[model samples]
Target: MSVRGFVPGVLATAAATACAYAVAALVPALNPTSVAVLLGALVTNVGLNRPFLRLGTQLAARHFLRVAVVLLGLQLSVPQLLHLGGLGLAVVVVTVGLTFTGTRLLGRWFGVPPARSLLIATGFSICGASAVAAMEPVADGDEQDTSTAIALVTLCGSLAIVALPLLRQPLGLDAASFGSWVGASVHDIGQTVATADRVPGALTAAVVVKLTRVILLAPMVAGVALVRRHRSPDTARARIRPPVPLFVAGFLLAVAIASLNAVSPATLSVAKDVQGTLLVAALFALGTGIHLPTLLRTGGRSLALALTSWVLIAGVAYAGVRLAGL
Candidate 1:
């Protein structure tokens, strides 16, 4: 429980994420940065760790990816938030609140195990794998639960990648507004761009709103962790502090990098590409590594929760988008 000896996992997470980045850079087909990262990370989860690397893999993934996300913020433009201003802030508050509450309440009602329920909720509400990683420790999500959360996020997020952009094309919405809609509704930042590109100006708005939402992680995690601690204070002698999750910090860093334009668009794009690959592999790992017996034992509950969460999320996301006139 001390987790003092878990250093190896940390190392592995970095190595895996890095390996993903390298692969993305090398692959010409993958232009978007998140795609590569998603693919590479997924590959690492399935191929690299299988039969040999599993020992510290999850630890590495859980711990190191946060730092990577911090490093990722090489792209954020703070001034943009000012440009979008009130609308951006509103989007963040509304989307996050809806997703978190819907998933939590619905999942609980459906009887999903607590960890799986939280994983589904957070992934749906925030930036997929990264958000799940950030929430994992606070919720005490074990390996399987973490994988499940990441898997669902990746699967759903990937679909959004292809669907959102195309979906917006027919809406007759302008670019900026489309971007905001995508960012507000879609799971990943990359997906937001793809979805918004079908329109004008929306891409930028989406990113701005998404980044602003990202900034709220500090408060959200801390508050959730605090509430969790109070709810289960008996067994836990000490409270779990869900400070700003490191990957979220890294994700912010990635945003900064993009914002400053310090890192070339090519480089940022490549990093995102790797992120995509990583996501694919993570999904595979999630599927393959599942403990069938355990899932069978708890799956009925999880399914119920997942369905309820989805209903709540869909209802809220739709309402919020409509309320914003998107």
Candidate 2:
């Protein structure tokens, strides 16, 4: 598509994202990312998403999200992950692996399609909407599948910001333990931060643990690509030649640069701001693709899968945290 074709949609998405930011600022409890998705959905369901805006929205949803994921790597530090210690690391790995595998199996049992299942599993297992976006090309899911997965993950993550903190005391978790659990269970980094921030001394652990899970995203995508290629060598070869997508490689490179402390704090801070804005905008674009009536009709099974996955992750992470004595 021509660059000009994307202008209208991109501009519309930008406007919506700005609105989302404004609303989030007014409502301190709300996340801009969540607000962006809602605004996009509202516009689409209300029939305001015009034909001329489609191309730009599509571009924003796909390319902009990928770029945001790349910038996300700057927030990770290798040494910080190492500081999680052996048992803490084990908790993260086991929780992610089990949640991912179990969610996929649950999707199959629910008769959900493979692509949507994979996207859901990825989103719930790794890092929410960003993970869903990253896995889209590898899974060969359509826009609907991507939007559904993003929606489910976003909802559950938002709920976590409230529910988990309330459970912290009942669960008998201290600040550090709560942080570990939040990091393990929450889908989005922002949600994790929100939940963990409710308890003093929890944010650092939550962020570090969440970033560790984010680190696993690249390998997970590559593994899925390899499995797909193995199952259908010819078709997969034609479509997905690289096991690791270029954007994923960029993510890794960004992580390495961050680890090396190559970028100055000022630059990193600016990159972080840009990353957040891009992600919010991309989510708004993705939201535009959601048809509320259609989503309501098809959401039953996906909602069940999402809820089940949410409980599974929380339970497993709780057990892991307790076992690890975090």
Candidate 3:
């Protein structure tokens, strides 16, 4: 695409993201990504998306999203990672593994296609829409599949923000336990943080546990790449894709730099702000690509899969919390 074509769409996405952030500031319960996505979808469905804008929007969704993810690593450090300890780490691993594996099995049982199923599994288990986008290329999924997965994950994450807090008293969970549960179960980092913020003393544990899951995003993507290559060596030979994408490697590098404590806290804070803004823009781009009618037509099976995955993660995380005595 020419510079003229690209800049307009990117600018439009940035404007939409700004609007999303403005809304989020007033309505704290509404995530910036969610708001961005909704606005993008609303604009496109209303026929406002033009040719030049479309190219930039696609670029935002594809490239900016990865950059945002890479910046996510600056949010963590080694001591914090170790702070989770053996028990916490074990719980995170088990929860992610089961959610990823179980979602796929359930998808197959429901007769969903493999590529869509894999994207859904990755989105639900790893990190919602970001994970779906990261895995889409590897899974060979279409735009429809990616959009559907993002929608399902976003819906479930939204529900968790409300439902989990309501269950806190009935579930007999202390702030730490509740935070851990939210971190484990919620699909997105923002939603997890929002849920945990409802309780006193929950924020620390929640961030730690959630970051643990975020760190796993790299390895999970690599693992999928390995599995795909193993399954079809001929195809692998014909077209070789790296097990770890460059952004993921950058994520790891950022984590390492942050762990070293060489970067100042102020710098890290700026990075976080930038990351969040990029994510908002990327999500807006992804949202613009979604066709609501098309999603509705094929949403039934995907909805079922999302609900089942939500239950699985919630149940498993609850059990992990109990077993850990958190």
Model 1 weakest 10-residue run by lDDT: 28-37
Model 1 ranges off by over 4 Å: 1-51, 72-80, 169-172, 198-201, 233-315
- Total backbone collisions, model 3: 0
Worst window of 10 by summed lDDT in candidate 3: 236-245
Sorted on TM-score, best first, the list reads: 2, 3, 1
Give lDDT tens digits, candidate 1, residues 182-263: 6766665655555555556676667776766665655576677777777877654334343545555556665666667777
Q: Per-model C-alpha lDDT, please?
A: 0.60, 0.91, 0.86
TM-score for all predictions?
Answer: 0.70, 0.97, 0.96
The list of candidate 2 runs beyond 4 A from truth reads 236-240
Best by TM-score: 2
Clashing pairs in 2: none
Error of 3 at 77 (Å): 2.8
Which rank order by lDDT, best down to worst?
2, 3, 1
lDDT of 2 at 206: 90
| Whole-model alpha-carbon lDDT for candidate 2 | 0.91
Query: Model 3: per-residue lDDT, tens digit, 1-326?
Result: 36887889888998998899999999999888788878878987898887768889989988998998889889977787689998998999999999999999999998887899999999888788778877877788887787778878888898888899999999999999999998888988888888899888888888889888888888898888878877887874426677667788888899999989988989999999998899889988988877888878877888899899999999999999999986
